[model samples]
Target: MSTAVKNQLRVCLLSVQYNIMREMVNKVTFLTSVGFMVLNNAAILAQWFILLRLREDVGGYTMREIMLLWGLTAASFGLAHILFARAFSLPELIIGGKLDAYLVQPKNVLVSVITSSTSVSAIGDFLYGILLMGLCGLGLREWLLALLFTVTGTVIFTAFALLLGSVSFWFLRMDMLEGQVVMGMVSFATYPDGIFEGVSRYLLYFVVPVGMAVYDPVHVLVSFDAAMLLRVLGYAVLLTAVSAAAFYRGLRRYASGSLMGARV
Candidate 1:
């Protein structure tokens, strides 16, 4: 790899490590946050279990397949938050002039900003996801595919958040719209793809891209498909590029809040 790429990666890793350490300083709070998140996710999964018991399947998904769907979704969501938690707060930062802290740093502004924080509860979601995937009885190949899907899914999710949050540049107070768009994507991703049809299905694949993030991954896990895997990776790359371009384009319009504060 190039020296610049290596340096950027190193900076991101250090930022993530520092954020995690900072969150862990309050051990009790850290544990409680993580535990509560695990319980919250489990409660949601339990609803599916109760519903599945009554019916053979929902949208062509049985108990095991549903597990895979939830597993992928939770794992990807957790990983995204763990690595790029600040992406979700991009709108607030833009409006509040928090980007000023990142812009002055000797690192990629977007990377520095996004990696500057960590979500303690996300560790719980990641663990719970692994537990669910284990219960699904995946083979070695399936396990590898699941891991790859998790990474791609994380990229898609974080990129989507950045894309939505970038709107705060041209428009003022876009936090609500950004939250709704993200929530809508997550809400649709937990269910089976077979349920949506026509326009909704198209929107899932193109507009929100949940189909690329979750549905296609679950389908591939059920039955391996090289072509589908390639498409998922392609979508991830495309979305990342678009989001990065949008962020830089918007950066030119950014006005400093002129508030002075130290990151440390």
Candidate 2:
């Protein structure tokens, strides 16, 4: 290849790296907010309840590693707001028929709505993530890779939210059911992926991907297994594609009445 071509590829990779760094900073901010909002005010032993007990029960884990893991857990939830902060409004828009206005707008409705609101709740997650990164014995390169895992995991989880929210167009009347299911998925992904057994584990990791969002990616972060990390990338790609396809399919079925469907 030409020297110019090599330099161009190098610059492109650097740009991508820069963007990832900026996003990690954003994730850090989101987790930080969550700490101030919820975790910080709670008793320190809440850490014991939410974090320490798991290490004791699981064995072969240290308090420091547990703290990093706990921070990851917090950051995971914080990053979820990246999708859910907007997902929360979809049912209301559908119910009120204001969704029609969005349909007529000159921009992508999802883009507009998602951009219009953000989950500040994610700030807590970001706070915890930075702390977790600081606890590492790993090099900065390793730390950056972990951030990539967390961010990719965050995107996959948002895809989960998008999948759930898109269901509104189908049942219209079933938004509550949709919301409950998404929230339930939230419960599933909040903890480490290792804790579950058998079919439930299969469901979260491959079938639905909630556990992959935190568990597999975090596992790769903790262990530095290239093969396992590659598997996560594959899962992320497949899940994102499936969710996007599902959302567009649901979009075709959307029926905005004269706000009449909701009144009945």
Candidate 3:
């Protein structure tokens, strides 16, 4: 790589390190928030145990498979929040004119904004993901597959958030729209892919792609389909391109809020 590119990466990494250190300043509060989130997630997973007891499976997913799905869901979301938490609040940043600080920076605006802060609670969710994977009795290969899926899924989740939040550049009141899109993606991501059919299924793979982030990953881990994994990775790349294009295009329409503030 060129020296300039290497320098840019070094700056980004340092920025991320600073953000993490900031988050760690209040170690007690950070640890408590992370621990509570993990417990809350576990409570939600417990409902699946009750449901599975009443039937062989729900949405063609066995109990074990469902566990994997939850694991992937939490892990992907955890990574997104940990690294790209600002993407989730892109609408607010734009609408509130908070992008001005990032705009003045020499680095990539989106990356700088997203990596400006780290979500401490997400660390717990990531640990829970590993614990759940162990519960699945995954072999070394499956564990590695899960890690790959988590990485791609994290990128996809962040891109999707950016795509949805970019609407604020055109319509300033996109908070509701962002919530709907994100919540819909999360709702579908934790379920079996077989449950949805027809257009809904198509939308899952295309519009939102929660299936690719969660279901397809789990499926690939279980069966190891080269084509399917490639499709997931390919879709992530395409989504990322689309998201970046959309953000920059909308930036042309961005009216500065003129308020100087950093993302908290």
The TM-score leader among the candidates is 1
Query: Who is ahead in lDDT, 1 or 2?
Result: 1
lDDT of each: 0.93, 0.61, 0.86
How much lDDT does candidate 1 score? 0.93
| Candidate scoring better on TM-score of 2 and 3 | 3
Report the alpha-carbon TM-score of model 2 versus the true structure.
0.71
Off by over 4 Å in 2: 1-35, 38-61, 82-84, 136-138, 257-264
Estimate candidate 3's alpha-carbon lDDT, on a 0 to 1 scale.
0.86
For candidate 1, the 10 contiguous residues with the lowest summed lDDT are 98-107
Every model's TM-score = 0.97, 0.71, 0.94
| Model 3 Cα shift for residue 207 (angstroms) | 1.2
Task: Give lDDT tens digits, candidate 3, residues 189-249.
Answer: 8878878899999999878889889989988987889999999999999999999999999
Model 1 scores a TM of: 0.97
Per-residue alpha-carbon lDDT of candidate 1 for residues 141-235, written as tens digits (9 for 90 to 100)? 99999999999999999999999999999999899999898989999999898889999999999999999999999999998889999999999
Q: Give a tens-digit lDDT track for model 2, residues 46-161.
A: 65466555556433335544455555555655665643456555666655665665577554556444333455656555666666656666678767876777677667766766
